[model samples]
Target: MYKATMKIFSGTDTGIPNYSCKTSGPLAAIIEGLPTELSSQFSSLSRMYHYPQISYMSGNLFMSDTVKFPYFYRTVPSELHLCTGIIKLLKFFSWTWVSIIAADDDSSMRAVQILKDGIEQNGGCIQFIKTFSHSRTIPLEDMVNLYIKTSSANVIILYADKRYTGAIKYMNVLQIPQKVWIITAEWDFLSHYSLGFDDKNNTLTFLKTKKNIPSFYKFVREVNPALFPNDSLTDLWWKDLCTNQCPESIRRSCGSNEISPYFMHCDTIHLGNIYSVYNSVYALAHALHNVVISDSANTTMWSGESQKFLDFLPWKLHHYLKNLHFTNALGEEMRFDENGDLSIGYDIINTVFLPDGTQRNEIVGSFNPYAPLGQDFTINEKAIVWDSEFTQIPPKSKCSPSCLPGFRKLTREREPLCCYDCIPCPEGEVSNQTDMDTCMKCPEDQWPNQKRDACIPKVVIFLSYEEPLGIALTLIYILLFLINAVILGIFIIYQHTPIVKANNRSLSYILLISLMLCFLCSLIFIGRPGKVTCLFRQTVFGITFSISLASVLAKTVTVVIAFHATKPGNKLRKWMDSRFSYFIVLSCSFLQAVFCLFWLFTAPPFPFHNMQSETGTILIECNEGSLIAFYCVLGYLGFLAGISFIVAFLARNLPDSFNEAKYITFSMLVFCSVWVSFIPTYLSTRGKYTVAVETFAILASSAGLLGCMFFPKCYIILLRPDRNIKKFLTKNSK
Candidate 1:
């Protein structure tokens, strides 16, 4: 917070607000008071004389705290805002790994801490932060030179005030080329001084936003020692800037040789806090004017209370100053908040040093902390003056580059967060954006693309009849069905023959039909599985195969009974009839039907999309809802086939007329072999291939039963007519 004083003298600027203005009349006053810079001495004087001490230079934000220094009002915004804005500016340029060197003072240290925290909080990493005193430390310069030569960070924040900036000139600082310095408006005076470096075009100064004061430039330039000779300070300032051949009016250009190198610096027109100075003086003037007018309205002409006594009343002017609101010549509304800080933002200016050792300040950007996030800091990259050697490319200052898509950042163990490695996303997961912390999982119906940066719908697959495997299986099932039909027809035409009637011909008819149905059921498993199809495929295969096994069991039992009853008038003769055979077949098939009904009611199969089974594919296959129910159906068929195989094996060496029992034994062996292999093959396979395994088991077992049992009967009935007769059978029976 700087306090600019309005002195009685007609000068360009002064430091204290001791002067007051008045009208020509006895009781009339126009502008009585104006304020300027505030010091400890000025603070005491302002309170003693009821003055509002407005600061335009001290630049200490906490000094505006109403309780600490009640009379003080600051024009410079908080340095905390400047720190916040600098962090934003660094992030905008992706400068995370920068160094910070601050002055060893209260305000500079505080600003540095805020800036450090801001950098880290916004994914920025600080390479190093060191403080230097006005009493220059040898290590500060050595470390600066070392870091400039060794460090990758091209940006460095010099958090110092004017005193430290002036101190920089005296130090034998080594060349710091290729570095971009971030300093405050106080350092803008560096144009008048040098830090022993030729390359300083990359400096960015955070200046308190100031507007042009109309003819302030003309006044500063034209009014040389000739006009302000009485003011020795103004005379001295004019002689340093002007040659012995000084111009009366700068409207006429001076010779470049006659002018000082400082001419270019002055022509740069770098204005710091002049607007703050103007407002501070104007605020004091307005308060004094109001006090004079109010006293006039009371019809009192400097009566009772002396003007000196009235100046002692601090609260009178304090109230007006706190409530003070006015528009300046620049059309900007200026006001003081409760804390006594002016409502103004900062301007980011780039200092481009020319070949003549003079500088140019370009307003490249602006920062307003009061604005919303993402809208607060703005920069014009095209307007900034970068190092010409780098071909105008923006400097890079980061510990690590950003992690691209399809990869996640892995923080190094003993380093900063910005120094991290990028690793590919885990299997089945994806990272769609750059610098993502974690990978995401795709849905069941979707999968990550090859790059892992995006998700696409999973390929829905099933054993469709149009596919190559499905077409092959369909052709095989159809050809087997036709073979089964021809065999059934051959048996039907030769029903009266002895070979067909050898062991219950009705049982053969029932078994063939059941085997045909089993073949048809296996084909249903090949199509795209719907709710109805998935429900029926397993149950129907179980029921039809059970019926065929039951028929073979009945034939084997009858052969055993018929051979035993003929031996010694045994009781097995009473059980040898078509009614008992039909009852055996129906009873065994009914048990399988009961199991199917319970399975359907409890947990029937349904269509499901199996994603995890195969990458990037959704197996649109049947889900056998109950594993126990599925095994029970398969196990029941095995039990029936086992019973027939054992029964027929014991009676395989019976009379020649009962030759059908041996066929039943061999057919049961083939049936049992197919399903035993099916379980392991089915369990091991995935997706639609598992369904293909189960369907194959059904077709293979059904064909095994048909070929083993009926192939011999068909050959003897058609090819050998003599063996088809009752006489040939009776001869074999004897």
Candidate 2:
């Protein structure tokens, strides 16, 4: 739509009948004399001076009503693409009310019709349509008044031609507060200087096109390069003919003209046009090339006969042109619909002018295809001309949700963006504990034990004996054992006189063995329970008491022998040797071990049974495992203590020389005191701590045996031992 002067500087030699390049050449010179008329009133002048005599000479018509010039296809897009795009854009922006400016011309009126239809179809309303005449001299003030008076619409769509003087006059006023837009073919009118006024202050915005035209052209070339193959032929022929026919005054063809200064801000539009022109020429040339090659290859060369060639020429040429892609050039895809109108990728141009009043380029910063009126998209300014090349089509929407075992997808809308679904994490698997988009993995040592609706706490797969309370109690027992062992060792080493050793002779060894066993048992139990030591735990308990009770039995026997043989000629003194005490303890241990083995062979350990509870399942455990083993352990302990009590009572009146005789009685009393209270504590405890507390009581009782039997004897031997050492040493030697 840019205005150009038809300055014909030369005329062809039409009177002459013969020409050197007559066989095949452009007929511009011979056709310049033809007459032509424009259907649109804007071109009131005949505009026929631009025609040439060659146009008539070649029997070519200068666009009669039925024969539109094929070379000049309209650069303006179809109303359909624009309307559809505007509807989408409006929807994207959530704008529903639009104000429209309809041009008086047929083309502009049709475009307005399309815009209105698109808006309505997209669930939007056009509040009003303002009509304007296609006057060559419309006053700017009048347009401004019209715009200011209109208030029903949030968006304005102008369908005016690009004369721009009127638009510029209205736009420059700065008083306008509303958004302004246009769908004009010639966007150069918006260039900084095109409107014959300061357009910098203009409120006009645009549905960007021609923005990425140059980038599109470059992309086509990179993707496919053989575009415009016959361009050289056109160039050479035109040059030669112009040289021969025209005066030297007009050297530049239409191709070489400097862009108008009015298009300084419209670089993308200019580049897009250039690319479109290049692609058009490339597509035509490729079609011609294909037709020519195909004809030559099939024609008979012997007699120079071309019957088949001519017959197929028109058909082949049509076929080639119909499907020609010419992919190496922008706007080169030459596909036509049934109506013979080409559908090209939509592009927008924002025109700008140069200093010499020429439109040189479209504004690269703000040109692209008009997406739906309000759709938000980023301008690819790197090659503003390529912005529309990345345009994406909206995808189809689905209605049904694709639900997973532990998840369900939720939809926000009933249409386009319905593809997204919300997912819920299963139980034992956490959703973002903090705010998050989706579910996350469960905590360590735990898993999604149930449905993934929520994450529940998990128990360790293996039993844990390393709890804080268990560990603390275990340390306390170990410390007590160490303290008692140190005291017992001192008594055994320093207070080893026959008197003290004779009283509770085996108690020291018994405590050492039992404490060592207690320490080892704790270590075995104080971690994750597994298959290894769990089965032997009950048997180990039996062994601990067996050895402990046997030590007490030996002590009681020693005391009995001392008191009985204190009278003249008693045989018990002869039998009261350390070997006899060792024999008694060994016999008792063998008996306990035999009973334990018998029961162990009778029935062994099994998986802990569990019963259903309100929260989950409660595990059932039996440390002694069965009644038989329990009774056997208790009976052995009672028998040992009973024998000790009897022996201590008999020896109480025997001699004051036997200083530890009193401790033997005290040892029996303390052992009974701690152990007798253990049964009630054990029965009341819920689970494993019962075993733990009982083990502690047994350890305490063993400590008491050491304390009472050795403390006084240790005092006598180490501090006040001058009275008893000689007598004790002689008694031991005898």
Candidate 3:
């Protein structure tokens, strides 16, 4: 206690025996490195003397208790800020699993509790907490061996003082590399005592004050041995290293050795914690100046006994010290918080070994508690020089890598949520970025692409005339329609010819015209569907086929009745005229027209757009509004063809000259067969193929009727004109 007291107040001018000689005024003391035991002893004596005591390094929790130490204060921050800054640093590097090493003392134990609470609050877990004693009860070699064998944690936070140098030496003996060592403000890793650890590339030290202090450096260089003879730092100067036996030439040459190799100049050394001491002195001086100024205001004139007058009011400086706020000579803001501690800002230093045997600290990042929440901790990753093994990539301290795009996270069953596997998005859903929690659905008109990373537009489809199938069907229809026209023209030119007038010329003309219209109606099914074409296409197809089938029925009845009326007692001869055949054709055709009218007025086909059947496509088609009504039209046409087929089959073996019944029966058979297959094929197909099937059926059935009924007669009229005479026809009719 006597030695510490002399170091605090007594300089070369005042000896230990005469320390009470200059006691004229109230005085404040700035002390450094006060342990808890010494701080308690000093606080008791300071309270008894009524003088304020400010500590620069002691961060024990008891110093914050104003009731116990009323005059105690500190310029450095408390342990809470140190723990918070460490927690922030660990979280920035994603070091969730870590170990704790603290000294076996009450102050360090309290710091461990504070650090545990802070680490857990930031979602981190401590693997273990190991304590070391100053008495060396447990060997540091055994502790380091345990750390080497432990694979659970790669980060170790150490909260011990500089006296525990054995931990560093043990680590150096084991040659531990690639282990991250986190240190607090108390441990200066760049000091010469810790230089034995070769792998300092992974070491990070948190510091309360910056390493460089320009004003302090200038003050150190201006110190002369003559001015302050007993200054302790005078031995550190190279000028004091000269020997008295050295000559003048050698003495002048010795100037080269005056500069420090580490600091590059004689005055500048690594001023690690000395900045805190400088700030402490400035704080005490500012408070004392406030006291002197206040006292001089009440006095009439300046007196030489001002120090004596201020001695009577020693406790008055405590008020000014509580509220002292000023910028120090180093240009740092000097103020205390409500607990009489400075608001701590930490510099994250990366310790690297130089090419020589010395180690240097590089400032790579910082942690400021006064900043906003997320912006408080920042690091310059590019400026950092990592370990040799980890220079190509950053060290992996995370539980899992980040999920890539087009994938989502799926938490594992028995693991933490942060440690999970990535799963691809489901069908019809997509995730465009990395680590998406949920996938989104695409719109109805769009669909997911192959990779499921984006949505693309759908294609539109319809039966069009530009396709090959449509073009072929259209050409066949045109060719058959032209043949029918030529056959009609030939018959009209030879109106009196035997073959033209043999099988009812008017009915034949009507059948030819209806067949031509049937071929033209198929064009509606070839192109894109519209309202008008959908309404009229099916109706026109039904009505025209009905007309042609009625003509065949009338022709079949004429052949049967006319052959039977030539008998002696037959009454069918009276109904064998052309008018009866005409009435039969017109009445049957009119009934089909009425059925079509009812279908049009009640329910009809309309244009529709189908979107659901196939993905990534829209189908343009016709929707049969009333399916029953549409089937009724086909049923009625089949009825007409059935009646005609039955009557034509009965008279197919009559006199061959006037027997057109065989042609009608074969044509009706072909028509019925084509339409029967059309129903199932049209129902089973989808999109553009449905319309193509219906169009093909219409063209095939029409061509069948035209070929079976009219082609034979045309072959005889144009190729065999002699067979058309009355004598030959009478011979063939017998």
Candidate 4:
């Protein structure tokens, strides 16, 4: 250690008057090679003199501690970022089921816990983690074949130094022929290697990003003893001597791996990681320039006095190295991070072994931990070539298959989250994407499609005049209306006849007009239910039917009064006037009109969309704002019909000639039966059929009243006019 230190620096030499000491001893140390056991020793020794020691290769994980090695820096990134890059790479290919085979050495063992936590945290399963003994060939072969060769894990992450070729020397993953391996640059196959056919295929390597150092390849190819006979590197490769034993005038050319060191000529060689050492020289040069260069013409570093030469002091050189930044010949930024490491990432190489024993490292992807989230890791999967040992291209390494759309993932018991089963989505819900845990529900007015992956709009429907049901009901209502009109005409033409004069003739005319209005009210229920129609339809039905029933009650009362007044000395004669019967009709009809007005002003019906009443359709119907008010209106009409029926039935056997009480009773019975059944039928029906039922009730009851009360009178006036005189009337009145 002391001899090496003396060759690197002269601690006591300050170059006061002697210029030969200017370029000697430790201004700074450029430590090269991989991170090894000696790096810590060198780092500790370098820190004693306070010299800045910088390395270009990613080194020991423990070297990153500032307290232990504060002056240590590297151009390559730390080993911690390599673990992160491996995690991102595994996720990119969905290789969730994998194995970790590392060397039983400090460098590989340091990353075991980090890799375990990363793999498990991301829903991945680790079949096993084994540290193979590279020192014992027998144990190494058994452990590799026992745990990895027979296991189901297809992808193996091999972590070790490139110099240690233990388990992966033959790609012996659990002895599995179809295994894929992802090895680090420390196990670099980019250099010279003689492997079994198909051994390099299905293998990937994380190589440090490299740029062509100008003239580096040319210098390696053209290097000879004539160019630099004093340098040890050129002297070892080139020899131009004729030995006395073999007469070396018979020229000999030698390859890199030849056993004999003596050679007349040299072949080209691969320069691995030489670029990093070249960058190391540039780092030292830039640090010295800051201390040497001057902005002013007369203030150059050479012109400074001895006191200003303090910049060359060991500790003083560290300040410039700590904050050094520059661009290299390839236009790549070169700088050290706060932890004294370059923040460079890795390039993914798809190692391809050709048929003729040649090899190639195809750069198919990159992993940059310092990059933004989505752009950090990327791979061109199609560019990867598979090994002949595998039966498929881009081999699968998953615990379970993916769940298809319209299905949800159901995790298996006592298994990792990656192992799961797929279950179909429930009714009225959908899963539009694969691997969803929960399903979504459609809106109120929509329904799920057949695949349950989408929602479709519902069909909107109403009671329209264009449908078959509406057409038939329309023709029936209009025909009944015409029949009523024909009866009213017959009554007008037979105004002077005795049959027409019976049963309170004016009450008959009022009842006929109101019945016509009831028929027209049914038309309101047949068309598309709108705000104006829905508001007034039920009210109109209530008022018009009330008047018709009220007129019937008046006729029954008038017949009873006419009979009672015929008794001698009966006081009912005063109450038997036609005005008294008109008063009863007016008072009963007015009460119904008042109730209808109260209902309209309080809680009126309105058009509503009944979505729940049907599936995949919207039923446009009237919504009774208040159920109590709706029932009250029907009850009032029922009350009038009930009273009218009782009064007419009691007076059915009164003077048959002038009494139309029996016919009035039958009409009231029909009207009462039609509306009483309408309540349950209308409530139970759905869609446009409900409106049809109510319209049918209106037309049926109005036709009953018109046919029963007026059709017989037309028959008597037209078919038997001989009995129309007062003498015939007196005979019929008995």
Candidate 5:
């Protein structure tokens, strides 16, 4: 406790000899690494708490990144936070260009680095050519000469030790009138040399040795006269104590004759250091007291326990000092950071010299106490007369050019920045720089460029027979039909014997041709729409049904003929000739062909209406034409089914081998089953795949006839002697 009091009252050793000893100019507080002034004032009202009462600076001023001391909080926010404030100040001054003047000394150099870093970080420029620095070895005159020769800057920052007074003197000698604005570290406040004040006109006539300290003092006096108040706490305490008794015998020395007039001089003013020292002591005492009391509630207290108390005392003291409303002797708030540096308030005092050699000061502005006044802006960029002040322009950034139709940005700097290189969109894909990660694509109907860099128009519907998929299906169906026709011709030419002929081989030929036509007809309905498609599609469908129906009728008539021919003396027998059945089938086929021709002439096919996919692509289809054909096929299948059922009933009485009608019956059933499904399937399917479904139906029926009926008969002829044509005829003839 005694040690702390000694540190404050013990003068020169703690630095700032003038403020401590009171042998020179007005007292000044030099704060470092903590709250300067305003932060402390705000803290004074924010908090209150109990803490240890001790006589030493017992709390830590050092801070962690996230939290600081409670009682011993900083007035300066932080280095980075201060930089942000500095940037804002620089931008306010509109200083686009400036030069830095840093001292060779470590502390001054650190402050210079901080300012320079802040300037660069804020997108401001600094001209290295105009920067100045003074080495410790350099004399003041030489430094000034170097500064004058290097640049014409109107503003000069002094980042140096208290010895900078020599440099200030030399600068004044170089320029008699104070044309340049000078800014220095707080150390300049301790200078004792006269600033060449002329008391006659109450003005400063030339550059002064004291620089701007006296001006700052005078301004402080005008703003707050209590700063230099007449009453003194120390003097009052001394007088009261001396009168109260003061160890009776010692009171004799305190008499009027023993007391010098110098004793009363102390009553007039209080030194700035007195308040800082007293506050430091009281804060230390308050922290220790709180710790001791807090620890006493939970554990024992001793010198050994003091270390544990030190750990928590800073926080407890912070809670107490945050509401630092205590009045100090200096008439200014006394606050310190965790590092025990004083936090004080200061203002920019713009001083001008008059003819009478006295200086006049006016409050030009307020600034961050931890930062230099003009460090933010260059001298020329600053608003000298207030009206010509900087009109700040907001930062503007323009967006980059969008990707071209085939090209996309590979990597973008930002939304507004140009990408390094444009890449082509890949095939069947597209992209717009949605983010740095990936690009966006167009919908399905749209197709991307070769590189897939961007989207372009895509062909969604088949407009003509020349279209690729339609053309391919057409050529394939045509080639198949031609092969079928050739096979049917071979069957008619080579198998001409009576039984083969009598079975109505020509009708079989016509059936095969009709089936071929049925399969080929699907090509017309493969794609969405075309010019001739709508007009001819329905007529073609009708013909397909008619032809297929005639083939079924031919088989029915042939079946009836063979059955009637089995009975002698029947009236149906004579008319049941194979040639007659052939003629009837030909007539029926011709009649259907004519019906299809008539339909084509009267009511032509037309494009289907109301076709769309989930992806929003419109499809042109054959609607009425398709439905008409669909129903016709169903009707023909129904008719065939009726005939087959009736024939099977009648033939049930005949021998199984002689009739061989079960195979024919099964074939009819398959035909009916397949085509019956065609109607619903055709009506349900959309556009092109609908045609494939109908084609599938026809192929199924054809496969059933070829495999189930003809296959067995052919197997018997090829594999068995009993069913062999030559063997059967030879045995019967014998």
Candidate 6:
């Protein structure tokens, strides 16, 4: 074809062999696979002759400039689009670490540069790039070794034509299994040349053509040696088939005496590059049709029977070609952009390997540059056949697996963002999904689950009656209350007895009633905490214990005065009256009531839900509104107990019959000991335990007063009737 075009331009049959300088009549040329140097040469010639040249497969980036190649155009997309497509392919598969193999030429170098910039801009890294030439000095083995040594890239992109670098031959020899090879449109997998070493599962080819062009396939199938009798290539194809043993079916089908079924099957046909040629031809025909219509409607730029009109007609056709728009037989839009390059789409072909070792190309995906962002790449992953080594799972080409729930991603130091480590969510925070960059904190009423992946309602806790500790404390309070009631009953029954009359029997009655109230107050602490219980529990307990302590103090004072009044000092007898004892108990108990009243009116305790102190639990407890006020009530009670203890200790040796000062001193000692330890334990505990500690202290102190003060007296009064007599008590008091 090249020779024929050159012969026409040279005017060889017109007796002007050197008339190439006056070349004309050719309207335009659709050259396929023209080398950069040859295209440059033809571009210069086309400009001089005002003839337009449209290329079908020339991917040189330099041809994009209209100022430099005014008469040159291409139906195929430039290398820029191809580089962009390659980058998108790499990103889709997350193959950031990739190696490049390009032909040693200007076009391939520019393509590599574009690819490198694209990859780097998208947060991807290139491991290495190796250039190969037609020369044998750099052996294929050496290239393979370099690729293996310098790169851990699983994906290798090959960007060279078959003629320049024997890539298929070298690749077959290397037999690099488990590696994905990205092949450019410049070469195809020829079945005969594959040498049975081409692993289809490992190869992915990018083509600038649509799949299933039925018209083109029909054209290829109809071709035969009989129809093109003058074509020697077709005759050679027939002769080759005859040399081998032909199948009977193929011989009958092809109307030949001998032909193989393999030849007739037409399984080796590759239509990718050929489809581009088909589109290019249709594009030129559409542009010529428009040009002819324009010429017929306007003034003709020609004279009668003159070849001068042909010289200028090709230049006029350039304008029509520039504005051409049409749809091809395959129903694809064929148009060129401002740079005379077609907007092309690429089909991602997955090479499927059958169990029998035969292979075929399957269109599993496509990439359209004109699509919206993030939607340009579409892939049918289920249709893809991966390498045998990966089995059913897709090969992992990531730096790390996805971060699971309850974990977040931490980028590796000095590494790309894609390379990251997974870190668990902190204590109070949670991440409910995979690959979270940061974890979130749960709400106040909720807490993180055990896995820290979700928020759950916190458990409500209180000193409930159902708990063993609360039940035991309740039983103890009841028993002590009954015991105090029995003691009060015995004292009342023996009101007129000398043993009971000797002591301050009125103060004893008041003290027993107050102690019983103290036992009942502990019941308030054992049930579910509520607003009313929280407000009254502490106030009632403080006031009742204070009254009981005041009574004890009054009794101690009476014993001291009674002992001293019996001496020679006659004036002390007036101060020993029961009225003075009543005055002491009333005033002391009145002071405590005032303090408790102030606490209730000012800063009273209330039911509080404590969520922060302990995790996974909400402590339903009383919040002591004012710690100072609460302590003051306890301090006043202790002061009364202290006074009673001192007075009882001093008057313990008094000679009065039935002297109660010794028992009072021991009872105060036990009460002071139990309450003193309560402070630190109450402050140290939290949740239900805090309430438990206070309740235990109350029970212990109340029991101490009941056991020490009343138990001995009851023993003498009930069982030892002789010791309950006036003479026996007087002897013991001495």
Q: Compared to the true structure, candidate 4 yields what TM-score?
A: 0.78
**Which of 3 and 6 is ahead in TM-score?**
6
Tens-digit lDDT track of model 6 for 1-734:
34544564565554333365445444455455576556766676657666678776677887888898887877666777778888887877767677788888887888889998998887676767888775653555587776643456677888876565455475563257566778776654534333345554777777665545665444543546566656655554554344233323222234455343345323323533566666777777887788767766765545563356545667777887788789877677778788887767677777777888666678877776766878777788788888777532555455567788899889899876657899989988899997677999899888889888999989888888888988888888899899889999999998877677777789889989999999999899987788899888988998899889988998888888777777896788998878898898888878888988898899989988899768788888888888989999999988998998999998887765567898999999999999899999988987798888998998899889988988888888888877777777667442
lDDT of 1: 0.75
Taking all chains together, each candidate's TM-score versus the true structure is 0.87, 0.40, 0.64, 0.78, 0.36, 0.77
Each model's lDDT: 0.75, 0.49, 0.74, 0.74, 0.45, 0.75
Write candidate 4's Cα lDDT for 45-135 as tens digits.
6787677887766556778887898888877667777788888888877788998878787767887678878988876888888876656
Candidate 5 residue-wise lDDT, 1-734, digit = tens? 22332233334445431233534421111122222232333223222221212211111112312133233333322333333444454556444344455445444455567667776665444443222333332444565557544543322344333344444554553242222323442333221222332221111111111112223333322343234545665334334323422324222224453343333222112212333334555555554455456667888768776556654554555455544444344454455444433343233444444456444444444444444655532222231232112132221111223356456556445421222356665544566443222455666556555655556655455433667655765676676567566656555654653323434666666666766766566666665666587665545654554555555555665666666666767777777656776675666556555656655665555664432432334355555544454455346546655675567545544432434355567777787788777778876876556656765665566656544444554445445535545434223221
Q: Which stretches of candidate 2 lie over 4 Å from their true place?
A: 1-272, 300-436, 442-545, 553-584, 587-705, 708-734
All candidates in order of TM-score, best leading: 1, 4, 6, 3, 2, 5
Clashing pairs in 3: none
Q: In model 1, where do residues sit more than 4 Å from their true spots? A: 1-51, 166-178, 189-201, 221-231, 240-269, 294-299, 303-309, 353-359, 371-375, 718-722, 727-734
Residue 198: error of model 4 in Å? 2.3
3 against 4, candidate with superior TM-score = 4
C-alpha positional error of residue 575 in candidate 6 after TM-score superposition, expressed in Å:
5.7
> With candidate 2 superimposed using the best TM-score fit, by how many Å does residue 104's alpha carbon deviate from the native?
22
Give the candidate number with the greatest TM-score: 1
The per-candidate count of clashes, in order, stands at 20, 59, 0, 7, 42, 0
Tell me the tens digit of each residue's lDDT in model 3 across 1-734. Answer: 75656534444343353354454433555455576557767787667656688887776766787787777878666766778889888887777767788888888898899888887787666767888875573455577777644545667888876666665554562245666778887765565443356754777777775645665444444544466666545544536324332223222123555533332112124535566676778888898888778877787645667656765554787788788888876567778776777655777788776668555668888887766888777787766666775533345454455567677778778765555688888877778876566777877767778777787776778877788887887888788889889988988988788887878899999999999999899888878899999998888998898889889899989888878888998999899789999898889889888988887888878888887766668787888788888888889888988898899888888876646888888998998999899999988987788888988888888888889998888887889888877665545564
lDDT of model 5, residue 8: 34
Residue 594 of model 3 has an lDDT of 90
The RMSD (Cα, Å) of candidate 3 is: 8.2
lDDT of 1 at 651: 87
